[model samples]
Target: MASHLFVSSTRSFSCLSLILKPSPPLLGVKTLFSRSTRFPRTYKPLVRHGSNAHPKLLSALSSAPPVVAWKSSELSSARDDVVILGIETSCDDTAAAVVRGNGEILSQMVSSQADLLSRYGGVAPKMAEEAHSLVIDEVVQRALDNANLSGNDLSAVAVTIGPGLSLCLRVGVQKARKLAGRFNLPIVNVHHMEAHALVARLIERDLQFPFLALLISGGHNLLILAHELGHYLQLGTTIDDAIGEAYDKTARWLGLDMGKGGGPALEELALEGDANSINFSIPMRQHKDCNFSYAGLKTQVRVVMESKNISIENNPISSANSEDRRLRADIAASFQRVAVLHLEERCQRAIDWAIKIEPSIKHMVVSGGVASNKHVRARLRHVVETNDLQLICPPPSLCTDNGVMIAWTGIEHFLSGRFDPPPPADEPDDAMFELRPRWPLGEEYPKGKSEARSVKRARVHPSLTSMIQGSFQQQL
Candidate 1:
């Protein structure tokens, strides 16, 4: 059942930098904006409205600043580039991309799932997986065609490994392995969440680590430090439904279509919302580990709807004229405000830790579909300024589930010499070609606290510990 929808579901080469200088090498790291100089005016002034308490934004995230900085170095203009291929199937979309390591996208394609689940309301994993099974081959063909390259033209293949629906993941992984086996293509098992962290590099190559990365998507809400390339230390994770899930469920309750979903639609409505009109307090105000809980917020939304006797799953939110639009906007605004606050609170702790070593992390990159929210963008920008952390989010297209991110991640794995013996594409067809419900991007890379595995697998490589520093050194 899953493999059937899997076909419908949609869904990297990287540069390898060989170190020339041994010790604390001085690469002319590009200058990154400390924060957006001007406020993004996409949303009307909500803070100026009648509200007693301020959002408190990132006040606590700014303890140590970047004043104590890296030893400066003189550098040269760079021209060398990497070409990579990325494939994403962490959930319902079949996507693929070709990106230049220099931060330019050559080609990207997504076969969406909105039409498949429109009647059903919400996604059924089995149906989604089946969709993947049916359409993935064509999707890959389309991506490769769009890139003006065949599979043989790819340096490596990057496939999302986990932090997703197991059924959907299988179709992508299985296809990736088939390609790797047939082409002897180096395969990098990519982490859906980590890919969110690394895309910032494709855009802001000089982005420093020991900085906070908020990966808010359908399956996860992680607070992490990209201490180095390939390495990610999870400081905090979601204790409940992910921020994306909250947005999706809420969208469903509001009768938004599967095509629009929650995140994108909500963002559109929020433009007309009065964030202060709907009073929802921040959740997990008391948790200490930087861990987040979005389930409570989801429940709260449900409760509010129930109390108002508003229909969910059937009766979508109906705002017809300007007045109704205002109500939709208000709901969206309040929800966005709540989500942003939750992230801001947890990220504060992560930033505090980064400052202990680097003084200030140069960029506070927020990725994932929800990061595309204009209000979230606005709130986060303000937070970055208040805490002295630079706010960076990939362009909305890159922020969502796309092939460019996958291809870029694959390139990173390739440069790091991480390869796995993938399942042969020409092998006898059987369960071997079938999807596995389990795949881990970093599980085998390291164990316990600090131990990393030396042996390699077909999936995610590039020692995750690299996140602790810039393992992705600039040779430019």
Candidate 2:
């Protein structure tokens, strides 16, 4: 039987509940601190000493080496069931969670920067970093409190260390390093995109390796083939701006609410308008490659808005007359339709290319913040179904950045023995870890072995192709 440790905190007493079975015991444990409060408590080891041991046991114990403080190396060798505290500040949100080895999320907490979006128009890296610095400790403590566990109980610490704002990423990496050193836990540095992709497997057990993944977010637009744990085959990516970024820009131009993020606000406004009211050109219609380009579409929207004399500043969408509001909605709807169509074209090509490499690939996993968009999800679902593939998307909440995904990814990596040693005690926080603001998801497609060759031989379902082409033609 396995032992369970539950650590709960209260004003009067901090309780540590332990149910131990016959097994190798933890040794030489010392103090545990509640960082939220100033109080520190000490707990002695549960092992019996000297006279309490039987004669043979006493003889064996007397000859054994003295155990000092617990370290990650010792912990890994003693236990397979690990608990991870995942911290994520790779973007505007500060989030943390505690997850167990068996894909169970014990507790999760997120501190969003929605309040700052309106003031700054969008995420200002420095302001976002400042916000993360302020709330990260509280968010992490809340997660631990909700889980009824302490740092000492955690087997490892995981953090999103790359492909984000340099300032924001540093906040999370610094916090993770501090916890790893204090708790003597192994550290796992997770790739932000990989975490987004692998998190699907946690929610759907049937989701396996070598499936297609479409990761669309504020910063990324990627279509990849997940070959296995920590390995990916890149199929397509955005050549200019990501789809989510375009959504934000358009929303800002149209004066959509920024409180819930521009993408969601625009998505909501789009529902009220006719999608065909104003036809936006589908981007990259003539490009044969799977690579995406959204800059052209963004320029087109700007030009059209200017030509119509639409002023988001003088007459905000919230306070506009009915006629202006209708026009705003129409623009939102038209832009969303064309944006999703671009995704459909790329996805159709990607699915065909992927099947040639791995015929067993039958699921399309779309994730990231933009994947939470209802319009994006509904359209992508149609695209996947048309290709005879099941669509797997994490719940809208999980689609955005969260600690649960990072923790879950850590669990996968931990089980596979992929980890790094904690930072040296003498190292400075700034120098401890490297942050990749522009890290590619994996290696780019090789020159000679590009998916383009396979794409040439692969055939897209005629109905899907015609449906997409017809939509573009109607817009034209």
Candidate 3:
């Protein structure tokens, strides 16, 4: 690691004061402080072991590395010309994008690990990390190139720091720090789930805070109330696996194509069969809380598949005979129905609870990889509309894991002066960075649990019950 100089100062200043160490031949750069440590009001002496009382100062020094000095003016919160490059390697996707402060998407790029996912059945952390290391550079460069700009043109670098795989998060963080250092740009650390929720504001310019958001993906299912920038109250979360993971596992059990991801393939297959065919129970029916549980539903599908003698081996859709294919399709359709129904149920309760807390809430943003599903969007739309709230779902491309959301979320934080100074250009490869593999979006709502218990569970639609009984009897 590169040696770092520690500066101790108790005085406050309106701007940054930095001392530069001259390169080899020129020892001419004099220290601002005299040999006796006499210095100006804003200047402080260098210390080998400083007082541990200055945590903020220490954090700034340790996390951001060293070298370049940033003035307070440079950290202005209202710079309208701010352009950020957002980098996301939270999971299997390596994505990068350029987004203007005004929500203009200059360029975006994603290098997916669909092949790896298909081969391994899911994301293998070690393999996923290696894959990210290989393509992250190329993807970021492409994003910059397509934006008709270079790293130096960017005002700041925004990257997802947590709520994802630590190894994958590190790949993006290191690349971001390296770029920010090279370009002398500020850095903004982002929470992965917050990025998913805040990106809606980018698409819907009128999307104000105090709105409800249901973020669904392979690893997370969250219902949060966005109180304001950097302030949120989580209303619901997954007690078990996320909806996207359930979708992938269901697709695999049905022998659907694993290419292009299991969610899309399963959605397409569901389109061909009766959605009410299997009657798998919606998860968390007995519980009136917004918390989700897809694990049981996944098990239900496995049981029904086994009862029908469907092999769990790698049986592709193409190899299945006509009857087998239809049976699989029925299972797919039914599984998707219950999975989404669970989401719908949770969202309805969340909205009810949210509105009581923030009656001004008028829009509900549904985002994440699973939000790309037309069925999921449609179902959630009804729930939002019934509560007199407009539903805002980003375009299909933005719904999935991508760099644009990171870039956009970065813009939100940049405007609030929440960012770090650029690191040293020669920041070592082993330099430690802040990485959060399990960061929460925000704090849990204090009344969320109490309010949930008071909310009555709506009756399951009669048609759904009848369909469930019919499907179960037929299978037996």
Candidate 4:
């Protein structure tokens, strides 16, 4: 069975019946004037229904003695030059970036927890949260400074809200909310996996809707058919541990350097060893579906380690004898070969499935942390090319978690008028946030839906349920 975690869902658009005098319109601008009790008689009106109002307008309303009417040209300009600041703290990295609507990445900053991962062998959520807290402010500030802009200059503040560690995600979300509130900017809540998929669009301007995407990362392996922005049909997902998790475990067991995370270290080590040295079996050979499973392959490596008496406790890579090191490298080579073969096989099948449903799909986007692997990219590129489809892989920098993707995805949603209103600047620190640590990107295709749907649906947070349901209200 597959699972999902959501970040932001549709905000309620319920009509409020207010009995008040009508205000004069300017340039066909329709304003919904409302008094903020917390900020006193200041008419802080959000142009929810205005022909000239730009959805991405930044600090359009002032909280002073009187409300100012924005000119139509100003709103049009806002639409043309939407600037967004995106913050991401989904796991072990604290990342931020500033991007313009035209796909210009002004600045990007990432504070990686490499040392922590090296010491702890993996990310400890609470510890990761602390690390994010320590560097998040600096990272965001540096991104803004490098971009040569201030918070008020941004049209909206975007942040990854879910499909990550709750503790770690809070650091970024809280920062975004605070910044948005302080600057009176709209908030664009983003999904982590969605950002990974959509960031390819930022780089490839010609990419269009109804495409195929393979999102592979530390915690997820998903095959989705993107019908359009915010509309997707899930083709497949991991049935067990993700490929990145398997790589990390394999790297640790092999006593390989984990300073840069396991996937890259393993990929580097595989370069020296022969790929055909080990006879490890590929996973799920009998399963014709697109879903993935790495647990069995991981177990196979464990058995090999036990038989070879390669104990990590006694032999770190630095102290290992030449022969033992060679053996480890061979294992790395073999493991990566089969692991990627699994991805290749699933992608081929997913393409067949996706093409049947959406014949217009001409591209396959491969992205995420694992997608940064050169071997993975080359192998998948071959698969895509053979199917007569273009392969759209973001450069390695964009493949990994970063703020640019979030900002770009935010811009997509904002243009569609899908965003939340500005949060109150004085909101209490203890206020609850709308976080989705396990939100699904989209519904499973009926033909692919598993019996686990009920179980997965039951685990969703009530607030997330309302938002997700509201988001797909059109589908309903």
Best by TM-score: 4
lDDT (0-100) at residue 173 of candidate 4?
Answer: 93
Ranking by lDDT: 4, 3, 2, 1
Every candidate's lDDT: 0.62, 0.73, 0.74, 0.77
TM-score of each: 0.73, 0.78, 0.79, 0.83
For 1-476, candidate 3 gives per-residue lDDT tens digits of: 11111111121111121221212211111111111111111111122233322333333333432222334343232233457889999998889988876677777888888888888888889999999998888888878777777764676799988778889999999999999888667778888888888899999988887789999999999899887766678888877689999999988888777777999999999998888888788877777778888888999999999999999887788898989999998999999888988888889889889989999999999999999999988888888888889999999888998899999988776544345667899999999877767666656666555332232224312221132234334433
Cα deviation of 327, candidate 2, in Å: 0.7
| Candidate 1 local lDDT, 11-106, one digit each (tens) | 132232111111232233222121111111111111111122112211111121212122222111111233566778878787877765445676
The ten-residue window of minimal lDDT in model 1 covers 36-45
Which pairs clash in model 3?
162-436
Candidate 3 residue spans exceeding 4 A from truth: 1-79, 447-476
What TM-score does model 2 achieve against the real structure? 0.78
The superposed Cα distance between candidate 3 and the true structure at residue 417, in angstroms, equals 0.6
Against the true structure, candidate 3 reaches a TM-score of 0.79
- Displacement of the residue 224 alpha carbon in candidate 1, Å: 0.2
Alpha-carbon error at 241 in model 4, in Å? 0.2
- Model 2: how far residue 199 lies from native, Å: 0.8
> Against the true structure, candidate 3 has what lDDT?
0.74
Q: Sort every candidate by TM-score, greatest first.
A: 4, 3, 2, 1
